[model samples]
Target: MSSIKWPKKRLKRIVRCKYGDSLSKENREKGDVNVYGSNGVVGSHNKSISFGKTIIIGRKGSSGSVHFSENSCFPIDTTFFVDKTTTKADIKYLFYLLGLLELDKMNSDSAVPGLNREHAYSKEVLSPSYTEQKIIAKYLDKTCASIDTIISIKQKQLELLEALKKSIIHKAVTQGLEDSVEMKDSGVEWLGKIPRHWKAVKLKRISKIQSGLTLGKQYSGNLVKRSYLRVANVQDGYLDLQDVSTISLPKKTAAGLELKKGDVLMTEGGDLDKLGRGFLWEGQIEKCLHQNHIFAIRPIKSKLMAAFLTLITTSSYGRIYFEATGKKTTNLASTNASKIKAFPIPLPSKKEQGEIVDFLNKKTTQIEKLKKNIIKQIETLELYRKSIVHECVTGKRRITDNDLKE
Candidate 1:
C-alpha cells in the first residue's frame, strides 16, 4: 500500500428527524428541496431545514444510498440526514465513502426492510485529513465521470443496434426484400402487398391452434415424474425447461394433448406484451403437455418453416396484430382460436421461406454475439467501479499527484 496516513479515531456525527413528523409534499412550501428515501426527490416543499451542506442516508424501504446537496434540504420520514462534524473530516469525501458502503446489508429482514438510525450511526468509517480528502474526492469525481460517460455511450450504441435488429425483422416480415418488383394486392388489409407469387392465408388455414389443460384441476405430487410445461416454460423466442412444474392430468387428457417436437407453444393470457408470445418445442419430453394459458400451434409444413413462422408471429408485426385482436381487461389481454385464425400471414414459396430462415439464422447469431459482448462490458464496468470504491475508501489504494495529473 502507498504511504498515506490519517488519525484512527476520526470524529463524525449523525443526525435524523423524528418519524411521522417528517416533511411531506403537501406541507412543504415552495423554494425548498425535498428529499425522500433512497430514490430521492419525491416532491418539493417550501419549508427548509436549518442545516446546510449535509449528507442524507436512506433509512427505510431503500437503505444505504447516500446523497449530497450544497444547501438546505428537507428529508422525509424514510431518510436520515448527516451534517458535517467539527473534526478535520471532509463532508464531500464522507458522502462518496458512504455511497461505497452497502448499508442495505445492515437492514432488518422484515416485510419492509428497515435501518435503525442508532445502529447506522455507530458504524465505523475510514477518513484522511480534510485537505487530502478533498483532493481524493476531486480525483474520483473527474476519473469516474469519464468512465461513466464512456459506459453510457456504449449503452446507447447497444440500444440502437437492438432497435436496428427489430426494424430489420419487422420489415422482412411485413414487406418482401424487393420493393420495386411487381406487387399484387393482398386481400388482407394489414398485408398490403406480397411478391406476385406469394399468397396471404389465415393462420388457421396453415396451422392448428388450441389452448392447454387448466391448472390446479390437475396436480401430481411428484414434480420429477410428471413434469408438465407451464406458461413460464414458454419464453418469447425460446423454451425454458429449467423450472418445469408437474401436474396430474388424466391419462386420456395427457394422451390427447401430448407435446411433440416442432409444435409451436404460445402464451394466451398475461401482460399485453406477452399475450401472444411463443416458441417452438425442440425437446424430447414424453407425456409433457402445456398448461391452460398456453396455445399450441401445429403448422401445415408445405408453405411454412416452423422456426421462421414462429419468429414472424413473435416479432413486432405479430404483436401489432395480436394487440389489435385481443380483448383487454384490467391487467390481461386474451385471444381465441377464431381471432388467431383470422390473422393474416404472408406466405412465400418453400424455397424462399427456407432461404429467409437461413439468412435470419446467420444475422441473428451475430447480433446475439454482439449483445453478449455488450452485456459482458456492462458487468465489467460495474465490477471495476465497485473495486475502485473499495480500494479508495479502505486506504488500500492512495490517490497521488501523479494519478490526479493522469
Candidate 2:
C-alpha cells in the first residue's frame, strides 16, 4: 500500500481570510441560509453574505472557534470568514488545520478577547496535495462522526443512570423497601401509594421557614455585611460554594438568618428547573447567611432530619408539586414563602427517615462514581477525537487508506 506524501506550508500561503460583515438581528429576515457564528450556526437568515464553501474563525467573543459551512451562508461580524476570493487550499482541510493550530489560545484582545487575523495567518501549517487533503478530510469526517455518535450515546447513558438513581431515591423514600407490606393511597395522586404507617404533613407544621437577608435594601436597624449563600450556591440536592460572596444585612437579620448545622437550604425560585432546588446545610461555613432569594429551613430536630427533607424535595413527586404551584412566566418560576411552607412531606418514623437518608447517601454516591467514570470515558474519547483531527491535519500521523479498515 502506498502512503501519501505531504508538504509543510504557512497558512497564509495556502488560503486567504477576512472578518465577516456586520448584520443586525433586527434587520435580518428569516430565510434558508445558515447564519454562521464563531462556534457554529447561530440561526438562519434570508440573505447570503458569503458564497460557496466557507470557514468561519472567531474574531471576537468566542475567539478562535472555527466552523465550516458547505453552502453559501452569512457569517456575522463576530467572526472572520476564510475569503472565497483568494482561496487556494481545501476549505475542509483548513478547518481541521485550524483545529490543530489551537487558534483559541491566540487571543489578542485583553478586554473583550479577540483573534488577530494577521497573527492567525502567520502560523505555519502542513499543506497536503489536493488529493491527499481530500483523503485526510474524508477519513476525519467519517471517523469523528463515529466518535461523536459514541459520545452522544455515552451521554445518554449518563442521563439514564442519573434518572435511575433519582428513581431509586424516590422509591426508597416514599414507598420503602418492603413493597409487599400494606400500602395506602397518599391522597397526593403524584405520590401514589406510600407506607400505611406514614403520615403526610405540611412543612410549616414541622419546620420554621425563614427568608434570608435582602441585599441592596435599607434597613431600620443598624446593619453590617456578612457572607451569604446566593441562588447559585445551592444546587439540586447539594451546595457548590466555589464562588461565595457577601451581602449586607441588619445585624439582627444576619443573626436570625444564620445557617444551623441541620438547616436545609432551598432557593426561593428562578428558572423552572431551579424552582425547588436545594440541599441540607450541614454547617458548611461559620456565620453564613443566605440571600433573600434563598430560604433556610430550621426543621424541628425531634420531627425530621435535614438530609431526608432535601431528598424528598428533590424527588419527582415534590418536583411535580412545586412546578405546578410556582408562579411561572415564560422562563422563570418562583415558589413563594407560603407555598414552600405548605409543601407536603411524607412523615415516617425518625428512625425510618435516618435509614432512608443513609441508604440514599450510599446509593447516590455509588451512582455518582459510576457517572463520573462514564464522563471520564467521554472526556478521554473527546480528547482522543481532537488529537486525531490535529494529527491528521498537521501531518503528525500519516494518512493511509488502510486506516479506514481499523
Local accuracy by lDDT, each model: 0.71, 0.83
> 146, model 1: CA deviation in Å?
0.4
Specify the highest-lDDT model's number: 2
The residue-by-residue lDDT of candidate 2 on 1-406, one tens digit each, is 1224556666778877776878777878979988887778888889887778888888888899888888889999999887466476777777887877878888988899998878878987666778778788888988998999999999999999989998998898788767687988888756788899998888999999878777777666576877888888887656788999987667876888888888877787778876775677878889998888888888998998888888888888778888888999877888888988888788898999988888898999999999999999999999999999877876777767687666
Per-candidate TM vs. native? 0.77, 0.85
For candidate 2, what is the TM-score?
0.85
User: For each candidate, how many residue pairs have backbone atoms clashing (under 3 Å)?
Assistant: 6, 0
Q: Lowest summed lDDT over 10 consecutive residues: which window, candidate 2? A: 1-10
Clashing pairs in 1: 28-46, 29-45, 29-46, 30-46, 219-248, 220-248
Model 2, runs deviating above 4 Å: 1-13, 16-54, 58-61, 69-77, 82-86, 108-114, 217-225, 236-238, 247-253, 404-406
